[model samples]
Target: MQVRDATATKSVRQGWTGRTRVALVVALVALLTASMPASGVYADQSGGDNNSGQNALNAQQRAVLYNIARDTWKFYSADVDPNTHLPLDNIGPNGKRGTYTSAANVGVYLWAVVAAHDLGLISREGARAEIAFTLIEVAKLARDHGFLHQWYDTTSGHVIRNPGDIDCATETTPTFDNCYFISNVDNGWYASGLIVVRSAMPELRGLVNTLLNPMDFGLFYDSRPQTACNVNPAVTGNQPTGQMFGGYYVGLPVEQGSNWQHYYHNGALYSDPRISAYIGMGLHQMPGDVWWRSWRTLPPKQCPTDPDFSWQGQWPVGGYWQVYKDPQSGKRFNVWEGHYTYPGSDLTFIPTFAGGMFEALMANLVVPETTWGTKSFGLADRRAAQVQVKYTTEQLKYPVWGMSPSSTPDDTGGYGGYGVEGLRFPYFGSGADASHPNLGLSQCHGCATEDVVTPHASFIALDVLPQRAYTNIQALRRLYPDLYRPDGGFYDAVNPTTGGVGHRDLVLDQSMIMAALDNALNQRKLQRHFAADPASAAAHRYLSFEKLSIADTGNGDNSGGDSTGNNNG
Candidate 1:
């Protein structure tokens, strides 16, 4: 596998200079301190009676989102390789492939296809053809063991070889390499897509099962090749006991092989346990203990009470709290809250958004984190969604809302922060406004904060804050027409600083937008489909320890589980 030059890798972060960095800092302070208007501005535009604002706005947003998803289908069908039918990982303003494709893109494409078909955004026949074409392409890609490579050539369906700095590649010192490193999270996303597709069209069961079943996840967990770091440190009496926990390594390089050293985030691995645990549990790919034991040493949950910001409301972010142990001593010494790829010591006070708005909802869109056993994870989901909504209304002092870890139109990537009252982490990246002059170099599309507005985050929070989510969607369409595609869906994100929609259309972003919108409009159709599966059902059963009793179920309000039960299960 060939590795691209450092220049190619540095292209994403090419523009930010020290002057712009200072300007960005000033811009953030101004926006945060500036008074914001109320949420009623958009609600008042619903045309319907005040009481009907929510419903009317929802309907209006749904219509636009549906079209947007429909327009996005062309990228997978017409704009892709005619032979493979795999959409490019990115599309430029000129409608050309900006980069190679990847398993992550395919996974999202599959989800979008299902949503489009299920929601009647595309004809059934059209969807079946697209689905079949995509599956054939997936079958053709080179695989690490049985998993697809992180990135693929747009036309040949061959591996892209090097995907640069993204987590999909094997993280190596000096440089990251694509080298057919198998991505555990990418596989999970791909598998979830397969599950969703199978749920919709049972006819493809054999195909789905064949593609889904292979590949031993244990390979990623137990295999730790020798490096400067000790191999089997426990046996050498050099590593701590409980410090050796099992989880999937981020990826496996073709040459270096599958090992802890090749894992992403400097071999620390993703702390969002749900990526592998829940997916593996649902698919019966691994033992339930493999999933549950990861939390063997979690510290007790405590909601911080910070009056300046609503920290108390942001608990149990199920994904928060990485338990860092001294690899040699094996003593659990620290627990840091937030969705982080590295351990607790790596970040927290850097002023960076440790967890983007997207992290809060990406996995939840499918697994129903709202019902997960970790009470705080579920509570955080709702609170994060609510805070993000309010952030748009009251903090950003703009009409737009929702930020996540995404590339700004200028191609810089970072996490978004809600400029909430006292919670303003000055160095935190990714903020935007709907109105006002927050658009200067401080709000530069490509600033250090990776500041950009992503509607995908809003759509993901549909269940938690549908009204606010829908309101933002409408605002994006009505006020920021550049981000709105004629097909009714939105571009991957907007350079809110420049008020321009990005030229590139992202597959994963589209898939998320479609899935969230479909779930919002059709009574959570995608979630219900995913939950109905035995593997997902089994996983959820293990997770929902505080499920409601028969009395709670009888309350009509208790859909199925006990809503009032302790959420911190």
Candidate 2:
């Protein structure tokens, strides 16, 4: 197995003969694709809107997706903390045990377990026991107002706050004392998994509800953007730019003696953390217009020039201004459906903070964003996947296409923030003001020798770009025979050039693969589970009734006439 040692900082294991590589590629292709017919849905690429595209995956394709989920579930089924019953964050061929876990990992593990049963990998009783045990132990874990802390020791179910075992993005002091942050994004995933569990296994809804009842997504929401973030209504006529603050810092307030909420906000509406905001709005804990408050690419009026706008973004996007009226409040909001044009191409898309797959597509796992928001997020979701493919194959010329944040392709258990950085533009927002021009790890155009392929990323895009995703998965396994493990579908990450593999199975990644497969094969079982909830119904109109600038929906602003702003159409 070959791996990338970026910067030549460390030696990556490499031992592959040219002849051996050719033989493996030839042999593996036959085994994986031998059954598929050369003709039909596999060849056409129109985003799968036809009978052969999204309508149906051939029996062979369905079997392969199901089997992959079955294999991926094996990781979750076995990697349990005996005392806590919570899944470990990650494990290698025999990666050390008693490792730490996060709220996202624990939640995704629950989804994996339920999905395994839904796919018949486990019996109903077996799945119920697994989820019940994990929930019971989860009740014992420490929390702030029902939102789980970012990290917890798996074995003892203890909060790993002070000097937390993992890197704290908000690390402030040398002691890592500011490590205790309750993540809105992590809990969003946790709550998403709980919705799946409760909906799929009604017998256990009581236990799931006990844990969910106390959770108030509203605690993290701000109804007044003017009051919370000091945005003036004078500059922008407003319904209210009420937003969801990113997450909470447990300690470390502005004042030394008293406790105050220390928070960060996810300005990008497409980020994975939006999952928490979705859940909150679905349950009516948060206002529906908060949905409009998030920027499609930051409002054109205030972007780039506004002092409050984040310069660390793919700003100056092309889009249209539209208004969405909240039925609950009868207030109309001005919104920007801004999208980035793929450099040197006519296509436009909505890019995430890091231009990663899960960051853009993961929330779609439980919530059917593409199905309801067909004109808005759905179109963007398709563009998101397509641009990734075009950049990886057409531009970067990599043999495969799954670029996302995954383990660095080595045995060190290091993490890599890989993505189709050049999907549009290289990150230019690294400049302090405008002159210093620092290139942070934002976007990169044609940056080769540093790309990574994650199999879960392909699965994440399965709903949007099925055929390409399927083809890419086969390409990965064929080109690198070692990429697929015995019980796991594929290793976490791989270097396309060397076929180097990252052999760790992250619970979050594996669970994503399971949820994707479950959706593809079982007619969106998890999505149906979420849709069955009355709460999801409350959030339905917000998704279904809007027209984004990305495509023609015929009747623009479908939520009645635009009462507030000029139709920028």
Candidate 3:
């Protein structure tokens, strides 16, 4: 059986054969006719009632948002794991359905269920059945150290081997030792799902407890192998010591005596940063000091060669405390780095250019980020998102503005690995910036030169930028209706240069589109539920010590202290 590589693109599938393309074209025609409105006339594209001092979604905006939720809920309802009812990773890329389960996808689905229910899109019985089935299946998962496998076969509910690749095991294939390995962020999403379930369905307390208890968050710290580097702290190695910085190893080997080598460790505090912190603070998985220590122990490095590299942590991001000055323009902007890696040497640390369009927004899905205190990454992240939207629209000229570190169609027919990218203008190479004039990756000179617009990148911004989000959604409905799939969600990405779209419909992305819109429209129900929950409340209480320090240090002023300047829209 053929399984799509789960780790390839956030929402891309393998290349389709000629035969499949013909079939897909036929299916696409039928899908468009059935799903889209015949006239394609949106009710109202005008940004609604700005004079009222409240920039709410217009009528057309609301309809598309509702459709996004309905289409995604319909897919989850129809295409989920038969036994567990969790969303399958992929569906109908080449008319082939996915058979494996994704924990992060399930987490997104759980939130979608809540969103759908709140929006009156699904019946109570339907939502209850979906939630109940998911919990039951999750409870029965073949776990190692109380964590679910990254991928699971739908039929047998058995772990799939190397799910990130084509070597993923089928239901009939025998499971291997590494198949039981844990994905920390994925499990964090699972825990997030359970917490949301418990928040919504109080009667399911017993069932939720059974499902949540086995998640041994404590194992992340205690399970490290006591090697020489660990035992002798004086050894001064790259690996972390004393505390577990972030999520545990990628996959824990099933062998009772498996060493740390078998486990894929992400000891850095910022490795996928938010999920571990979310679950850690929200679930009381570890003590406050442990969490604080993990962050404190984070390694710091700087790049002196590249002036664009700027300070160790600072970037020309729009809305953060740590902002950088564009060496040429002498302007402060809030562009956060995608990563801070020490590739060449210990002292030669280089920070990647930019972050995902929705990386920081993902944490906002559950946490009421604006209320989570100013010192945290919340405000800075939002500002960074605003910067991205502005850059994509003004600089890149995407019909709608949104871009992220996602997959893209390569000049070589196949797709490129994920990178900080977006849709490119036709004349992508005529010195768009004063610095790094010939910016690109691979043979396609325009590859890294321009930004790509995505649906969720716009949808997730609804709360922060309501009128902009509404305008973008309406534009999507009017101009790029082709992106609106029959499944009720937009495709993951689109390249403006080639006019190519992603193949797969990612549950995480779709779920975000739906849930984020719901939060923006309906009093932020999801974030309120997550923030007000006891686990998170306790986590916040314990972290008071660190948060206080954060509050003490403001993001700085325009005199080179603050990222959110008066000029920032």
Q: Model 3: per-residue lDDT, tens digit, 1-569?
A: 11221211112213444345334434533443354332211121112222123456667767766666666555554456554555777564565566777677778788887777777766554466556656666767676666776677776676667444443443343333445446667777777777776666654555666667667665654333332221323322333333453344343332244443444334333224446555764455654333433331122222222122222222221122233443323444322233221111111111123345555466667655544534444444445454555446555556666665444522222223332332232223433333423222111233343445667777777766666666777676567556666554676666655566665566777788777866866677776556545655643443221221112223222222222222311
Candidate No. with top TM-score: 2
Candidate lDDT (C-alpha), each: 0.49, 0.66, 0.50
Model 1, residue 457: C-alpha shift (Å): 1.3
Which has the higher lDDT value, candidate number 1 or candidate number 3? 3
RMSD of each: 17.1, 13.4, 13.9
lDDT of 1: 0.49
Q: Model 1 segments beyond 4 Å from truth? A: 1-65, 71-75, 163-176, 222-259, 264-273, 289-353, 371-376, 390-398, 411-423, 426-450, 546-569
TM-score of 1: 0.64
lDDT of 1 at 340: 15
Question: What are the runs in model 2 whose C-alpha is more than 4 Å off?
Answer: 1-55, 162-179, 225-230, 233-241, 251-262, 302-305, 308-315, 423-450, 552-569
**What's the lDDT of the predicted structure labeled candidate 2?**
0.66
Clashes of 3: 21
> Clashing residue pairs, candidate 2?
2-500
Write model 1 residue lDDT over 125-174, tens digit each, in one string.
Answer: 44555566577668767675567776777766655555333442233442
